[model samples]
Target: MGIFKIEGGKQLKGQIQPQGAKNEALQILCAVLLTPEKVTIHNIPDIIDVNKLIDLLGNLGVTVEKLASGSYTFQAKTVNLQYLESEAFKQDGRGLRGSIMIVGPLLARFGKGYIPKPGGDKIGRRRLDTHFEGFIKLGATFRYNREDYFYGVEATQLQGTNMLLDEASVTGTANIVMAAVLAKGTTTIYNAACEPYLQQLCNMLNRMGAKIKGIGSNLLTIEGVTSLQGTVHTMLPDMIEIGSWIGLAAMTKSELTITNVNWEYLGQIPNVFRKLGITVEKRGDDIFIPAHKNGYEIQNYIDGSVLTISDAPWPGFTPDLLSIILVVATQARGSVLIHQKMFESRLFFVDKLIDMGAKIILCDPHRAVVIGHDFKSQLKATTMTSPDIRAGVSLLIAALSAKGTSTIHNIEQIDRGYEHIDMRLKAIGAQIERV
Candidate 1:
């Protein structure tokens, strides 16, 4: 059942919980390799990409045990360094994009790390240069095998130094931070990504006895430590998923509650949805999206110009949720421009929405104009393919609000990010089934 068969025009109700963050789980899971002691993590999302990383850790001889649902304990006391070069390791690493993150932890403690080209959503060109460059500044020798698309880094010992990242990449910063936690000197990372995910990693490392300062800022200073201890960490709710639920509720004219949304960490998400005139009421830690018996409206700029939304680093709108925002706008009351600054191919799925009667003009690969239908006419159901994780969920949201049954192929992309989405939606009155 790799496809989702959704019966549209259903009014969904009841509450849903956003799973642990997919991004944060990737970084935090890789960080278990930094220590040999037992580390327990709670709120772990049961998703494909994260499960792949956990299985990869098992292959590397990190003893992982399931303590309970959404909880696990891991110990890397006897890591199998030889597995790094095995054919089986190559295949496992190739299938998971999060596998690249294990390099820093392995290189730090074992003095060597090797990885085949990692895989994930084929959204666009994602460079590994920043990660390697950071490792190089930490005094690790880097080598690349072009024929095999393999990368390796080795050092007798890593000596940390000052470096400015070419781009504020979240994964790159996470990799560099993990490596620097075990280096011999001070490491100053400027222009580092300070997303909530990165901050969570730093906090977890500090709990494990690493010296990290300037969390939630672009400049991070890491005082190297000889070794780290084990600690427990609980992840924040997935803000992207919360935003998607907001979009889903608005599109379907349904009243829904999203619990324990971690409001402060949500940053610009609720506000951005408000810009589209979706009422997001906060009750305790939960988000209540009222049924839009009357359609929502898009707010104009202060000067009465069209509202423009764009993606940036942390404290800015996340690129991950722009697709949901775009899909929600198809039924709002005004026009808006969505500028997808980071990824070149992310906005390509708008054509699928267009096929379902959305009045979206693809301005380019990175920009689009969404003219809201104001619920005057419903989207016509259609079959579509999921291109990437975010786009896949966005399409699913569109299908759930369309006029008839809709079929979405390549739901594996969705499964990689959202945990038990079909089952959870079914619990909340969504007519979605795995077929």
Candidate 2:
């Protein structure tokens, strides 16, 4: 585990570039297994989860070549199917949740797929029923080994069919889409997750000769192709990271400019922050946030009701940013409710904020009511542990705004999502050290 020692009460002023989307990279990297030819991908984020996936791919006998810092060519000409049954592979596969996405491409192209139980943050129950059920709907046989705790899917030839997912799961949609792209016939998926990551995966598959429509909508139609050819794909900037920077700037009263953000793809993120009375400016493709000198205030609803910020699907505010929103609301004027509808335990981190002198009431597992201090009271720094990736960054932001130096342990959680976070913040005049 790593620790970040941060000295708060410093104003940051500079420009920072968001890294490649981590979610997009996970799906894109898995898609490389669909073709035998070389698939070149650019703008890949260098994070722990992604690196673990890359290592797993190499272990599966895919030829990986580094073209540049954030560019790679993957050729899956000779995959070691036998390796999937190995104990070492099972242990490595369970290290990250995104590793489960590899099953779809493997099942589609090779007629069989296997994965160990996937592991990720303990925020809530992230079920895999959607992914497996979608595969089963596509004429695949699903079996789970209880003793070994492994999942395997097999089909001599997958036949496409219509699937209405129980929920619009992001990874589930990506997995099903990858499987359906190489099935025998057309596949229609309603209530599909159409986030930017999924859209990029569909576009990349289309370039590889897969027939897919509905680029940025919930309804997706894909016609199975016999085979896919290699293609080059570049990922969009990380919108979550962009949102994190916005919240950090506002909390620390910093003048920060986030560069080259895909403003079009960042749906409702800026507006969510603005609802909390944060200053967000759009200068072409960049976002410039001026320092909040007099302290920011929460905006009331049109009916003069307390504002409520909740998580929803794409084009809606992301659940990942709700933690940042909660932390930022601590210094705002007036009160607001933070509702984390998707994950139950994500709001528990607010207890740490309460320890730092923030007035937050933990209503339940999924909701919290925050009464903003509005800069009249400054949070005193303390020792804390990062619960998850998003919450870790939110805590880092809180420590940046606190009065004294704070130590955050288990920052490996933060590194899993954000690439070189301490280094990036340090370049922007932040007082942070990794120990």
lDDT string for model 1 (1-435, tens) is 499999999999999999999999999999999999999999999999999999999999999999999999999999999999999999999998889999999999999999999999887889999999999989999999999888999999999899999999999999999999999989999999999889999999999999999999999999999999999999999999999999999999999999999898999999999999999999999999999999999999999999999999998999999999999999999999999999999999999999999999998999999999999989999999999899999999999999899999999999999999999999989999898
Model 2, 1-435: lDDT tens per residue? 889999998999999999999989999999999999999999999999999999999999999999999999999999999999999989999989999999999999999999999998889999999999999999999999999889999999999899899999999999999999999999999999999889999999999999999878999999999999999999999999999999999999999999999899999999999999998999999999999999988999999999999999897899999999999999999999999999998999888999999999999999999999999999999999999999999999999999999999999999999999989999999999999
**Clash numbers, per candidate:** 0, 0
Global lDDT of model 1: 0.95
- In model 2, the Cα lDDT at residue 366 comes to 93
**Which runs of model 2 end up more than 4 angstroms from their true locations?**
none
How does residue 385 of candidate 2 score in lDDT? 100
Provide TM-scores for the models: 0.99, 0.99
Worst 10 residues of 2 by lDDT: 343-352
- The lDDT of model 2 is 0.95
